[model samples]
Target: MGSTASDEDYFQRGNLFWFTVITLSFGYYTWVVFWPQSIPYQSLGPLGPFTQYLVDHHHTFLHSGYWIAWLIHVGESLYAMVLCKSKGITDSRAQLLWFLQTFLFGIASLSILMAYRPKRQKRT
Candidate 1:
């Protein structure tokens, strides 16, 4: 008997470009929140005007945005866990990976779960 790609115990890697973009965005948010003064806000090119306004006048709003972003990611991760369970991905490691990835990458991970169509065996 041969095992196909569906038979493999793993999750989809998802879109690489989106993953990189999101990871960089999360890192940038962290930097903006933690070290606002250290950032060359004016030299951020097209991002300068908006970023400077947030850092200079709306710092509290910026902090709220950071927390809200993370809260949304947490909500998405919980949804990913539910989606995995419904999809029959009962393996603990796979579920954990899904949760972590969804938490970190948000929709990048959830989109794959949304597209997944599990293969089912016919019983005689």
Candidate 2:
């Protein structure tokens, strides 16, 4: 049997959640990196000045966290490529686009993937 309308709606909602998450994450990181001073922290928040924050946090767990995030982005790119292949998406340009977008935007790209994914062929 094929997916019902409710199933499609459920998937859309899930995709929207993921897209929102990715957008917020990117916005937060951009703010933290480029505009930390404007964060309206009552006191110096977890990290102080951006430059000093990097210097002081180097070799600490926070440093590791940055590397971990980088690794996750790499993994996401790989996952996007694999997902396109598994879904039988044969266009090289589309595959490349998804891979790059997933690497840069993470779950935002996943939302796009979900929305545009090929419908499964029903077996007789």
Best by lDDT: 1
- The 0-to-1 C-alpha lDDT of every candidate, in the order given, reads 0.79, 0.58
Q: Which ten residues in a row have the lowest lDDT in candidate 2?
A: 5-14
Candidate 1: list runs displaced more than 4 Å: 1-8, 121-124
Give lDDT: candidate 2, residue 114: 59
Candidate 1 vs. true structure, TM-score: 0.85
| Cα shift from native, residue 55, model 1 (Å) | 1.0
Q: Over the full model, what C-alpha lDDT does candidate 1 score relative to the true structure?
A: 0.79
Off by over 4 Å in 2: 1-59, 114-116, 120-124
